[model samples]
Target: MLLVFVLILIVVGLASGMLGSLVGIGGGMVIVPSLLYLGLFSISPLFSEVTPQVAVGTSLLVILVIGLSSTFAYLKQKTVDYKSGWMLFIGSGPGAIVGAWLNRFLSSEQFSLYFGIFIICIAILMMVRNYLKPVVIRKTFLYTAIGDNGDEVTYGYNVPVMLVISFSIGILAGLFGIGGGVLMVPVMILLFNFPTRIAVATSMLVIFLSAITGSITHMVLGNINWTYAGCLVVGAWFGAKIGAYLNNKLKAEYVLAIFRFVLLFVGIGLTIN
Candidate 1:
């Protein structure tokens, strides 16, 4: 059983990490929901007891490791914006602690229902971004927290705005065990007017910090499955690297489309199930 779970973690981890890196979204977008659905009784006949909430928690636990590992890779390339990274940390760090604590008070059914809705919303948002359509209401705020990592220029927009948004991102990270990239990347591009490259790079840096904070908290609560986490990450490492390799070859719009498709499928599955 342990071995089986380990394999699942690695496979899922690799896919989630790699695809996430390519798209500037956190792996949790893929990891959390997939695990939630898979844990549901409907996903597999044998694993009915695995509730969606457990899957969300478990997915968060594994992605913590993936975030740490991904951080090293980004840092190695000198691509991380340490300044912006810290700003987001400063804003969101406290909220994350609070959010993690709140998770204990919530039930699995609540997490599942909320999580499904969140995914569906995210999918729609990604589509809007890809099309360059006027975004009706982006809850995302601004943080003039661009990292100064060499000549690769990225503008920091409205510092005051960013501070507010940054805090919110932190809370989400803590509560959801995400790096807030799903929310961050879009805001960075739309609000800050950053190019695709900088936004993606920035998202990775933010994910590293938020994910580490979240994973440590989860580990303490004993919600993480080491064996399973390892299994999922086996694939995560390679997939992220591959995504990074292909980043220049791909466009953000196309990546967003894929995310939309994945979310739609998952959303439909939830409705039918």
Candidate 2:
């Protein structure tokens, strides 16, 4: 029974890691909802009674490990912006702690409902952005960054705005055990005027930072399920590699489209479950 449960977790991790790496979402979106659904019925004595908080915490723990693999892949591609990543990380670190603290108060049903609504909102936003004609947004030249292919890409962003956004991202990470990449990726492209690929890569780095802090807090709070997380991590390691490769291979529009589909699917699943 234990081995069967472990295998199931690994399969979940593989899917989560692949999607997370491709979209910079840190797999929390999938992990949290999936675990919650799994918790509906006891699969085995070794993996019974998976509470919402425990699922969230364990997802964050797995994300911490998955983030490293994703980050390294992005690093090798040279898509990561260290300066921006560091700034975001600074804000996210403390925010994660606060989020974890807040998570203590929510009931399982509340968590599921709210998280479902949030995902639905995000999905709608992405759909609008993708389908609607481009609306001109004001932007200034921030600087140029080296791209993965060794080309210089110029971008701009409002720092004061991003500071607040990054902080909020941390809170989301802690609260939902999500890497906050779903929100960050869109904001980076829309608000910061970053390229889609760059936003995805940089978001992965920030996810790593936030996930580490969030996971630690969850651990201290006794929210993590070590056996489950361990199994997921084993599969995530390999899945991340595949995801990174696919990220580089696929076009930006395709990536966004895929993300949109997943968001819609997961959001509805949570809402109805």
Candidate 3:
């Protein structure tokens, strides 16, 4: 039974890591709910009775691994925007601390309900993102990158505005163990006119930094399950590499379409369960 449970967790980690890296979400969206569902059912005696706090903390730990793996892979491709990622982390770091503190207040039921609704909202946003016009904000920073086809792509953002947005997203990351990229990717592409690949790559960097702070807070709170975390890390480490490789091959629009569907399905399942 213990072996079976470990295998199950590893599989979950693989899926979560692959999806997380591909989309820059750090795999927490999948990990949190999986932990909750397994705990709710008492799937294994070795790690039974997983609470929301533990689930979130454990997810964040796993996310740390996923982020590191994915970011390393992205760096090799020269897709990451390090300056922007660090700038965004300034706000997200403090916000993550606040969010981790806030997580102590939620019950399992509350966490599930809120997480479900939040995921559904994000799914809806993904669906409509292409149709929505980018908000016109004065640029305080500009960046240029060479595309796969050698065309120069330019993007820019207002630093203050982006910091505020990153802070808000960071709070969500810490609270839900989601790594913040679910929202950040869309915001970069739609709001800041970033190329899809660059946004995805850069989002991983921010997610990595935010996960460090968020996981540290959870560790201080004793919310982590080291046994489970270890198993997840093993799978996620390799899965992230696979995902990063695939990200370069896949079309952004197609990947997002599938991601939206998965989010909606998972959201509805989490809500009703």
**For each candidate, C-alpha RMSD in Å?**
4.9, 2.6, 1.5
My TM-score estimates for the predictions, one after another, are 0.80, 0.90, 0.95
| Better candidate number, 1 or 3, judged by TM-score | 3
- Tens digits of per-residue lDDT for model 1, 1-273: 645654665677777887777776668777766666455424333343444334545566655555566666666665566766676667666656666666766676566556667677778887777567423333343333334333444355666667788778767766765667888887766776665666777677677666666666766776564544556667876777766656656665666676688887776565444
User: Per-residue lDDT of 1-273 in model 2, one digit per residue for the tens?
Assistant: 667767888998998888889878888887887787766667766567778779889998888877899889999988888888887888888888888889989997788778888898888887886554433445543768765466886676656667788898899889988888888887777666577678888888888888888988999999998878888899887887788889988764676677778888888777776
Cand. 3 TM to true fold = 0.95
Query: Candidate 2 clashing pairs?
Result: none
**In order, what lDDT does every prediction score?**
0.65, 0.82, 0.88
lDDT of 3: 0.88
TM-score of 2: 0.90
Q: Which regions of candidate 3 are displaced past 4 Å? A: 41-45, 147-150
Instruction: Put down candidate 3 lDDT per residue, 152-182, tens digits, no spaces.
Output: 9778889899999999999999999888998
Give the number of the best model, judged by lDDT: 3
- Number of backbone collisions per candidate: 16, 0, 0
Candidate 2, residue 209: how far the Cα is off, in Å: 0.7
Error of 3 at 132 (Å): 2.1
